[model samples]
Target: MVLEAAVLYVKPGLEKAYESAFQQASAIISSMKGYRSHELQRCLEVKGKYLLLVEWESLEDHTIGFRQSVEYQDWKQLLHHFYEPFPVVEHFEKVDLT
Candidate 1:
């Protein structure tokens, strides 16, 4: 599995609106291929900061499969305007500890 993370800095005074938009946007992403699950976490200390985490079956399932799909455009249209400077997304894989 691959983990996708992003630190979203929403525009000031738009936190509630952003959350609402994200609720709508979530539907778009969850329906995509290889999508396992996702989360949106609000920061305790920061006023307009959120952490977004998404799980995919593979890297291509997200980077290419999701990002390249028509659904991505819907996702962007619903949630992209809420960011201040835009978030940088990164992917990770679990390390074996055994």
Candidate 2:
């Protein structure tokens, strides 16, 4: 599985709207191919910071399958405007320790 992570810095005073928009946008991503699961976490210390984590079957599932699809446009329209400077998204693969 590939883990997609992003630190979202929402515009101040728009946290509630951002969250609401995220709620609406979740469906867009969840329906995509290779989507496993996702979570949105609000920072306790930071006022407008959030952590977004999504699990995909592979990098292509996100970078290509989702990003290239029509649903991505809706996702962007719903949530992209909430970001101030935009977030940096990164992907990770699990390492077995045992």
Model 2 RMSD in Å is: 0.4
Q: Candidate 1 — worst ten consecutive residues by lDDT sum?
A: 73-82
Worst 10 contiguous positions by lDDT, candidate 2: 78-87
* Candidate 2 lDDT by residue in tens digits, 1-98: 99999999999999999999999999999999999999999999999999999999999999999999999999999999999889999999999999
**Model 1, 1-98: lDDT tens per residue?**
99999999999999999999999888889998999999999999999999999999999999999999999998889899989898999999999999
- TM-score of decoy 2: 0.99
Top candidate when judged by TM-score against the true structure: 2
Highest lDDT among the candidates is held by which one? 2
Question: Each prediction's Cα lDDT score?
Answer: 0.95, 0.98
Supply candidate 1's per-residue lDDT for 68. 94
